[model samples]
Target: MNRSNTTALTQPGAPMKVRNVSKRFGAFTALDDVSLDVAAGELVCLLGPSGCGKTTLLRCIAGLERQDSGVLYLGDRDVSDLAPQARDYGILFQSYALFPNLSVEANIAYGLAGSNRDVVRKRVGEMLDLVGLSGSEKKFPGQLSGGQQQRVALARALAPAPSLLLLDEPMSALDARVREHLCTELRQLQRQLGITTLMVTHNQDEAMLMADRIAVMNNGKVEQYATPQDIYDKPATPFVAEFVGQGNWLPFQRSSDSHANVGGMSMRLAAGAGQAASGRLFCRPEAISVNPLLHEENLFPARVREITFLGNRCRMSFELNQLPGHALTAEVGSQDLPRLGAQDIFVALPPESLQVFA
Candidate 1:
């Protein structure tokens, strides 16, 4: 896909749809029929591990990488072949690619240089103030810190007031402290301006904090796209459940409509009612409870393998008797911390919190 034309920037509404976009590099396929809809004033984050095609999808949307097939629409206009500059999109690179030769003010004004000089100056000043860079506009990129440089980059992108703002790892360059501060500021600024934004990030915590919806991509495909709460509570696939957080994969065989044989013990599964061959059960760390005396109906006896202290919470890994060749990782509160390297610690696996995948 090559964008030979462009669109105007002063649009009235917000909505972007990427339909059946596919791209390939040599014989290796990069994107495989990826599609997503972003609403007006909504912040959607494309999240995945490295080499999962998140960045490739973003580049396709920006028209920097042409797709082998499929169409990208900005509102109702099809921009599958439109040029990047003509799409009227504001894109911020991960490295804060600011011009080292220009001052901060000049960098912001660069985007609007085609307009009248007075109008450009006014917009630059407004953008600099918006990004909290009031008086340092005279400083060049070399004279500013990483955080300041990133702010200048953001101001420059916003100076044109593009309809859709694209952020690719905007905070990845900042330190932990600065990343936290800027993430909050970015969220606040996007909301205040009601800009439709699409961000690509590999950090799960960053996606949960910054986006209204998250699209988890893997192997050039979207595994799941949902709200933060939904993604955390109910993941669609084993990959999603495992990638989103810490969990245990318990092996079990379907024995009947309502029950299954896990290891040697008969366990009931809400989903085993169907005649499925075999499946892996998902149990979150917080859902498994330590009960010496198995009181629950489907409770199992396990020995504590290891315990890791993670500041606010403690993680307990256990080995179940019925489940062979598998270990469970559980999350416990700091106050409810169990003894380290202890054995014969009985644990209960709650059914409501259990998710299964074949």
Candidate 2:
């Protein structure tokens, strides 16, 4: 959608403040003193595995579920005690929740009741055009494809031009290709309208692709919150390091702030590597080079244990000679497989790539 058109249809976004929100059910705690702030016009994703309180937190914000203790504010208005309908936000569910009996136009115009009929009709048409479903106005939800139904639901949520948008796994039901396409479209639309949005998803790729910032939750608390790259490269916790992406963890004994012993082989640590007496060193598989250049340091010998072809790249498993029974895997280009003959291979682990955590 065009910028001018989007601005004309939607109101300026508002910031949402959440302070020390806590929720519980009987003996179980769903949210544990969680706090977050969503800036105006920013898109943030609550990301974690299932049952991690991401959904519970989103529902709390929407008033679908109330928090036992916390303060919620949309801009300057305190909305902590307001009912769902009384809050200034619109929500799109994973199921789309479109009225199956109603036509596309009717669904989009549902929130426009009590207004001028002509104005509602015009607004519905504009929403349909904005979501690229203008020609399907007469079609029922059941008649349209999954993607189309989702578009209709999105149109409906945007029809009233709410200041905040809440999406709860909105694309999970669609196929992979369709879900990816919709993610891109949704991000573009959100940016064009400058709507403050909060989304809940367990999919790492989805959060990384769409969110301006991500809050990684674990066991009813936010473990870390930062941009996608920051979360991946400099995770604040070991769980965040392992959960967000693939990494190799090798047990190490620290001898000093700048040195550690991995499998009895002494290696220099990266600058600013925490002063842990002993811990595991974390490094991404891609950071380990199969064959070392002459200038590379920390070269170690390992034997290829197995090889698996994965379309464009090959995954090779290696047994580190110094650390028997321990294995490491690396992603290598398919074309370079021949260079790795039937013999021991040397791998280089760059110091800067290693992160030591106690």
Whose TM-score is greatest here? 2
lDDT of 1 by residue, 29-117 (tens): 88999999999878999999998999999999999999998899887888889999988788899998898999999988888867999
- Over 1-358, each residue of candidate 2 has an lDDT whose tens digit, in order, gives 3334777889989999999999999988999999899999999999999999999999999999989999999999999999998888989999999998999999999988899999999999899889888788899999999999998999999989999999999999999999999999999999999999999999999999999999999989999999999998888889999889888889999877788998889888888767788989888887888875465778888998899999999888887889878888888889888888875998888898888889
> In every candidate, how many clashes are there?
8, 0
Q: Of the candidates shown, which would achieve the greatest lDDT relative to the real structure?
A: 2
TM-score for each of the candidates: 0.91, 0.97
Cα RMSD for predicted model 2 = 1.3
Summing lDDT over every window of 10 consecutive residues in candidate 2, give the lowest-scoring window.
Answer: 1-10
